[model samples]
Target: MKVGLYFGSFNPIHVGHLVIANHMAEYSDLDQVWFVVTPHNPFKKKNSLLDDYQRLEMVYRATKDYTKLKPSDIEFKLPQPNYTINTLAYLQDKYANFEFALIMGEDNLKSFHKWKNYDVILENHHVYVYPRISGNHIETQFDNHTKIHHIDAPVMELSSTFIRKAIKAGKNVKPMLPEFVWEYLDEMNFYK
Candidate 1:
């Protein structure tokens, strides 16, 4: 199976994330899109995030109905502060028959070169880049790279930070989240 790994913190899975994942699964050649719930992102502050299992639960609740979208806790089982290169290597070894690709926003592409063993990742897997509103400059080398594909997906500006803040301030951000995820967050009193 051709799978696109959509790695994120998914502190509270929201509609914006669903839209992009659905778009990739339906519009692209990818057969499925797996939302890899990262336990901790090296770039993000750990304290700001919810419990790893809590975030994973939100992801599972959000993606339960989508047959093409799956929630993966693969990173949770792996080491903390994991890099994309290591995850890619691990996935490649475990699922030799499955072709794995990356699903990322345009903003991340700007710093792609800085990733550890990025060259090896580019050579091994295809990167499916979705549009982001961020006006960051991308490297000229990846502009026309064969391994990098710029998908004409919608620009999702909504972020988990915004949702968390909104909920904390006693705002009804239910519309921003999936029905089940909203219920789960509300019941758990997360971010409030």
Candidate 2:
């Protein structure tokens, strides 16, 4: 089976996330898009991050109805400061029958070289990058071994930070998130 790994914090999963995953699954060769919830990203700041388990639950809730989209807590069991290369290695070892590809925003592609063991990842994995407002400028320094595919998906400006701020301020997030996910967030008082 071919799987596209969509890694993110998923502080509170929203419609935008689902849209991209659906797009990838429907339009690409990938059979499924797994939301790999990262416990802590080495490249990102630690402050204001929700608990990993909580984030996983939100992802689960958001993606429950989509058969092709799965929320995975794989990174939660791994060591802190989760690295994509390490996760890819682990997944390959655990699921030898499955072929996994990386799914990320165009922004991440710009700094792909800064990631741990980037050369190995580039050589081994197929990356599907979706366009984002930032990080569209690609450098010509990438190695030839990397297989990068650009995907065109509708851009939703909503972000986890903005959603969190809205929730904290008691503002409506109905337009930003899916109906069910918005309900769950309100019931759990997430981002409060």
Q: Worst lDDT window (10 residues) for model 2?
A: 137-146
User: For model 2, what is the error of residue 136's alpha carbon versus the real structure, in angstroms, after optimal superposition?
Assistant: 5.8
The count of backbone overlaps in candidate 1 is 0
For all predictions, the C-alpha RMSD in Å is 2.0, 2.5
* Residue pairs with clashing backbones, model 2: none
Q: Rate the local accuracy (lDDT) of all candidates.
A: 0.90, 0.84
lDDT of 2 by residue, 18-96 (tens): 9999999999899999999888665787666877787887888888888999999888778876678889999999999
| C-alpha lDDT (0 to 100) for residue 63 of candidate 1 | 92
Candidate 1 stretches greater than 4 Å from native: 41-45, 134-139
The candidate scoring highest on TM-score is 1
Residue 19 local lDDT, model 2: 91
lDDT of 1 by residue, 73-176 (tens): 99987877788899999999999999999999887888889999999999899999998885554555689899998888887789999999999899999889
Model 1 alpha-carbon miss at residue 119, Å:
0.3
**Candidate 1: TM-score?**
0.94
